[model samples]
Target: METKIQTGPVSTKAQMQTVPKKKFKVKSLLGYAAFVGPALLFFLVIQILPFLMGLYYSFTSWNGVSSAVEWVGLENYLKIFTNDPAFFNSFIFTTKFMFAAVIISNVIGFAFALMLNAALKTKNVLRTVFFLPNVIGGLLLGFIWQFIFVKGFASLGNMTGLEFFKMPWLGDETTAFWGIVIVFAWQTSGYMMVIYIAALQGVDTSLLEAAKMDGASAWTLLTKIIVPLILPAFTICLFLTISMAFKIFDLNISLTGGGPFNSTQSVAINIYQEAFQNNRYGLGTAKSILFFVVVAIFTTVQVMMTKKREVEA
Candidate 1:
């Protein structure tokens, strides 16, 4: 009995160790929360909340001004599908614009990237010059180009006696479509050039030297060696240009005001008019949700395809 009474608190040390570990875990959690808490809260409040609200609003018949929100179920979506020619026209215009703008911008951008990637004295200056257009605000750029189309080009045409500059740049549907494409490509190409330049710099020079030693032609080197390695850049630039072209608003709005009739109206412009101008808030939200789905599908597919190419590369 006396020996039994001499038994120590056997689990005391183990309990002490566990206390510190629990404290450490709490501290680590606090650290994570300290770093990520504010940003998470801000994102939830700003982006996620609004999106959820829009999703709910899409099913309602609430005009922007009215306090009484009527739940109209799928009526807004039905109207968009059946009765909305303008919206469809806007979508068609946007799709066409996306193709043109993406192709032109990426081509011009890749060309600029190739040109500037080479060692030259004036390369830096030319880089700055090309990139300057991107620095200008879209609305401002649109206005400036609008003036050029109307006044500056007209003056130039008179001076040069060239019919090329004398054509209506933003009047007819075909010309207006091309006009937006030109402005978009000009504004976007420089940015793409910068991206491509960065990718080009990362390429292995030793491989390039070996390719040259193997008697590969310049075109062969570019097409085989250069392009494949920088496929990621193509993916990024194409994605950027596609999305930007699809959602073109400020430039088109300021440049042509969707004009000469709504021939050049973008999906964004149509959504804006439907929601705010026409006060069909529900219908507008529905259109936005639908457009969002379409865009998400496109961008997701593009990213997946590009990622597969990246893995293959």
Candidate 2:
């Protein structure tokens, strides 16, 4: 029985390979720790701490600057739901803005993405031009639009005789609502477009080819095939639009400053006014918590509902 004795060279090579494998496992574990530890620590410090503090402060009657936090239980929350008319008004305005912004922004964004995705000579440059507005700070964008609505539009109206441009865009209730919508759409459409474009690009070419072979019209292809396939992107865009619209503050401040009568104030602006401006810290904290809950609930319900539709489609 010639037992083939493994050579020392072979044993040495095997040991060398094993040594690298062991080192790799240890190194990978260390790398994971290095990456995850800092992130977890930051989340604890920045996010968790503030969240806990906010929750604690919601039960207190302490003004934001006060050292004495007198716990008043559910009084703050009760006041908002029971005694607060302004809160309700802000809610109404926020809901309306959210509906309008989500519809217009997603529609325009999806439209632009569709057109740009269709090969055109100036598509890249066009995308850059369209997306440039989104990169500007919200406050700056709001101020620029303010000038356009206030000064530029007046000049244009004077020159071109367009009455609509001369209307009180930032001063009146109806016009202010639309003004916010217009600014929001302009600022956000590019972002939504980028998402839609990526989703559109990911769609299977073969599916489109089959649809074409079946003599599906362009409209039908878009309606039945393309739209259904990009439902995930729709979910994301809808979430972004809804959250951004509800929490709109910079544009509201810069453009209207809750103007003409707090008619254009979103929930965030209203909360700010209540807490800091009015010194109702407890009530404001309560409102903030409620706002968080409302957004979370609405977003969750919307995502689940749309995800179901996506599956059905």
Candidate 3:
């Protein structure tokens, strides 16, 4: 009885602790709302909404400005596969462009990265100069190259009497493709170089020293030590190059407008023509959706393959 009487008031400490927990949960919810709310809203409104709308319109016939949209089921897709020669041509063109751009860009970029990594004078300035083209807008760069290809280089050809520069870089199918590849490589290599430079810097100096102590040549150090260690960078660079090559649009447009005879047309340009020029919006949407799937699949496979190699390395 005496011990029971000692407990005069019940402890409310446990209840008080739980009150702060409720407040903390509310505070956490509010914080999340403050941080992520705006971004989520914008993403939904801009990207997700358009994507869903595109999907809907792909199954319908609308002239892009019409009040009425008629459902055509799978007609647009079927027509794209069976009847659209332009779509196939664009696909073939895009593949060719991708192959050339990826190879040249990566090769040149890796080479530059290696050179810059060496103890050389003016490496930083060289990096900045190489990266300047990447900072310039793609459309602007395209136009600049167009001028060089037509007006500037033509003038140089006249003065030097060089047959190579005399050929129509943007007019001929063979030369036009190479022109695109060359410009793209020039523009993007700097960015890739930065990545490779970082990777090269991360390499263990001790391992390099050990290789050198073992009398390994420069080529052997690059092949066995440098290359193997920087495999992750290779994976990233390849992924970026592949994606950029596949989705190229502004450069292709400004350089040739898929012309001379649509010989250099890319899938993006083809979609633009179908949607705007021909008023086949549904068909264009269908093609775009297919293009998106192809790119997604290709990028996914490439990343997986490259990542596996990185692990093996």
Where in model 3 is the C-alpha error above 4 Å? 1-22
Q: For candidate 1, lDDT tens digit of each residue in 166-269?
A: 98998988988899999999999999999999999999999999999999999999999999999999899888887888889999999999987999999999
- Evaluated against the true structure, the overall lDDT of model 1 is 0.93
lDDT of 3 by residue, 182-213 (tens): 99999999999999999999999999999899
Q: Total clashes, candidate 1?
A: 0
Q: lDDT per prediction? A: 0.93, 0.93, 0.92
lDDT of 2 at 179: 93
Please identify which of the two predictions, 2 or 3, would achieve the higher TM-score against the true structure: 3
The true-versus-predicted C-alpha distance at residue 263 of model 3, in Å, is 0.5
Tens-place lDDT digits, model 2, residues 56-120? 88998978887888999999988988999989999999999999999999999999999999989
TM-score of 3: 0.91
* Lowest summed lDDT window (length 10), candidate 2: 258-267
Q: Top TM-score: which candidate number? A: 1
